[model samples]
Target: MSLELANYEAQAREAVKMFWGNREAALAKQVASGNQDAGTRGAVTAGKNMDGFLALAQSLVSANGLAMADIHVQRRVLTLPGFFRPTKLWDMLVIYRGQLVAALEFKSQVGPSFGNNFNNRSEEAIGTAHDLWTAYREGAFGEDSARPFLGWVMLVEDCPASRSAVRDTEPHFPVFPEFKGASYSTRYDLLCKKLVQEGLYTSAAFLSSPRTAAGDGAYTHLSELTSLKTFVTDFSAHIAAVAAR
Candidate 1:
């Protein structure tokens, strides 16, 4: 099966839009009725719903090129020998060309800037990478395998916040008690560096293309907008890349 980048982008866009529309409708009802709690809960519920939609989207994208029966999306924790620590993750797992190819972590945000939620997501990605690395080192991978796994951070760029967040400036996440004094971006960068240096990741690329310098008085586009159609197309190419790995 081949990945369809355009379709992926379209589906992602539609799903997000639908999720937001539903949220807004509910919020409007609550506001008219003066239900503050409902509005508040609606915000949280919207995020959860988006997450669920993304989870399913990952599966759909994976299923097209790969056998749905063989491949698993959102694989849970499977304890490996000698690596006793358990960390459960919901990753889009691909079994391409008879080999485990990639594990994707889809992230969608309205704004460019990442808030507390982004911190959690970064932690999840880093932790999942660690677990996979440990498993591979302990001979957990199947025969005819690609030992190193790939990681992806997919974004739906719509809000100004997200635009500001992914700018060329140094990225930083807010600090929590667990991270002590380090910025979230600092921590995330360090983790990514270590993983890449250790040969855990193949190579890193952002789906959103950075704006380029066009001619005089013009701006170049950097990050590419991801829609359902785009996602399917990108998925096709990504699958091919993983197979070559």
Candidate 2:
């Protein structure tokens, strides 16, 4: 089976709709009017909007020989064993005959909060990888023989706030050369590429979409190294190999 991108434009638009819907619902129900939390808290409410991408991911698993029953998307069974933590909920997971096949995390970033969330996002991504790999090293996934494929996808909103250059202030020591004047978008692209280079993830994708026209399914890749095409190509190869075995 071949790896082909699904109708991403429709899915992306759905994600945007979900994001705004969740945030608006939260604002109406969760926080006090005119409070600082009211505006910002809603931003975190609709994170699951990106779950549509998981459907595309599921396609990869299905194409690779795993059946629908083998893949888990619901949070209940999506929990995977962790080293530092008892367990972590993953966005998507595939298991075949008690052997771990793949686990992926889908994440997104939207504007007005990029600055406040970038560091947290970075730490979360790295820490999750560390926990999973360490757990695998300790034989966390039962008697599984081969390593499980780990994937990360970052969908950032394409807006002025995210694309503008950001200043770096290194008070104590010098920051990395790549991030000296990188914008949030560029920083995320670097993060995706570096995660693969550092062997933290099997494949990673960096995507940008605009909220208003997301339904048009328009998204941009920051670089070839971190592009979704590359991620899918690598992941397809891995999954195809695993299925063959």
Candidate 3:
């Protein structure tokens, strides 16, 4: 792994761990103080997973020497002038370089199969894309050059050992109400298809081995996965090269 990759990974790991520490402490206190929901235990675990995803996403970008536009970006559009106005909000908008380069929604899961989880995420991405497209059309996003947009659904690998811990107290993990029981593979497949349809992502591929090349529709594993660091390094370089062009 390159020094840049290693540094980003370390930073990401620490940030995620800190996020979890604070979140878990809060939840635990709630439980200890008798204000906890049994169902919330699952949700807590899911939150940890989300922390990991967020950290990784940040790391992925930072490894390329890119910083998010701001930690928190909420841009709104109000249609109509006064009483009949409707407002639209965009969550966690980010910028890379001087251009509006990227946007992402992070997700996490602790289950064997995605089942409906996939659908909900897919729908969310679709809606986000729709909103972005609408905003672009309405001139809310400005008319410089077209920027890249993306949706990400990060999942925790479901190994046999972690399943019981994940399911003991929580009946269902946090799933989008609409997309219950959807498989991860299915979700990824559909998302990739939609991204292609909308011209958002050029390609997707599964990372079978550390040596796997980035290709069309590839789904890379996160754990024990070789070459991920290398892949990110290359990805960062590629993005920089593209931005230069």
Using all chains and alpha carbons, the TM-scores for the candidates as numbered come to 0.52, 0.86, 0.54
Scanning candidate 1 in windows of ten residues, the lowest lDDT window is: 211-220
Q: Cα-based RMSD of the predictions, in order?
A: 8.7, 3.1, 9.8
What stretches of model 2 exceed 4 Å from their correct place? 1-37
lDDT of 1 at 61: 45
Ranking by TM-score: 2, 3, 1
lDDT of 2: 0.78
**Predicted structure with the largest lDDT when compared to the true one:** 2
Give the alpha-carbon lDDT of every model: 0.46, 0.78, 0.44
Q: Please give the clash total of every predicted structure, in order.
A: 51, 1, 20
* Greater-lDDT candidate between 1 and 2: 2
Give the alpha carbon lDDT tens digit for every residue of 115-211 in model 1. Answer: 6656676566566666777776666666446653465444333334444423233359654443454433433444444444566554322332211
Where does the lowest 10-residue lDDT sum fall in candidate 3?
208-217
